[model samples]
Target: MATEPIAEDLAGICVDSHGSAIGMPQLCADWIPNQVFWLVIALVVTFFVLSRIALPRIASVLAERHGTITNDIAAAEELKRQAADAEKAYEKALADARAEAQAISQKTRDEIKAQLDEAVEAADAQIAAKTAESEKAIADIRASALENVELVAKDTAGAIVAALGGSADAATISAAVGNRMKG
Candidate 1:
């Protein structure tokens, strides 16, 4: 019986708190309706603020970034093009230099060949001239030896005749030569 009374009291308190407009205004009536209106207003204000202020700023920033990226890409392309041109120019110059060097080397080789040929010709002529002079000298020596032999023969014949008291004739000289040869 006591538990039944306490239960009734608790039930009464629960009904008063939940029911509309007796002590305090009903919990939902006091704030929930007003809160709903304020929530709608805040959402409308947030939409306007985002669309007019924040979203435009974000879009402009994105557009500026895109423009900057495009400009950077263009500049990079220009630099790449310039680099390619420079490389081509460098290759052309290197090719020209190699060609020029080959030409110079060929010219130098030709000049060296010509000089060698001239030097060979000059040396051959000098050798020929010296050979000719040596041959002439040998001929002169042979001729001189022959002349001396003839002169010595004449002198020896006269001496033999004088030594033999004028009796030595050609036959005697011949016999003497034969005897000398035998000895």
Candidate 2:
């Protein structure tokens, strides 16, 4: 019975006379063509799956990312331009405000100076009027004092002549008093 042929199954090909494995089954010549055929089928299936499904999805995702980056850069440039314009406008407005402020200050100063000048002129006019009035009053007082002194002197002289019993004329006493006053 030991010499009779053993029935062969898929697992029996690599066995020896005592049913022990010979070397490695994957390296056996009998199974090499079957392994190579299955490897080619697996590689073809993997390539089709990547090309039809996985590769297209990855490419679309990369394209979307690139478009987003480009749009973001464009938006940033536009904002930068707008910022520069706004800065220019702000500077111009600030300069205009400064000029307007200076103009207003100058105008106010001129108006104040004009009002001060008018006030000074009015005060000078009032002082001049007061001075003229005071001079006229002094002149009037001096004239009245002189007339009073002359009257008193004439009365006193007439009294002295009467006391001495000289009988002086009124016209002669008046003429003498007038000559002394002229000197």
Best TM-score among the predictions, by candidate number: 2
Assess every candidate by TM-score.
0.67, 0.77
Tens-digit per-residue lDDT, 78-111, candidate 1: 9999999999999999999999999999999999
Residues 109-133, model 2: lDDT tens digits: 9999999999999999999999999
Error of 1 at 17 (Å): 3.1
Each model's lDDT: 0.79, 0.89
On lDDT, the leading prediction is 2
| Regions more than 4 Å wrong, model 1 | 1-33, 167-183
Clashing pairs in 2: none
- Clash number for each model: 0, 0
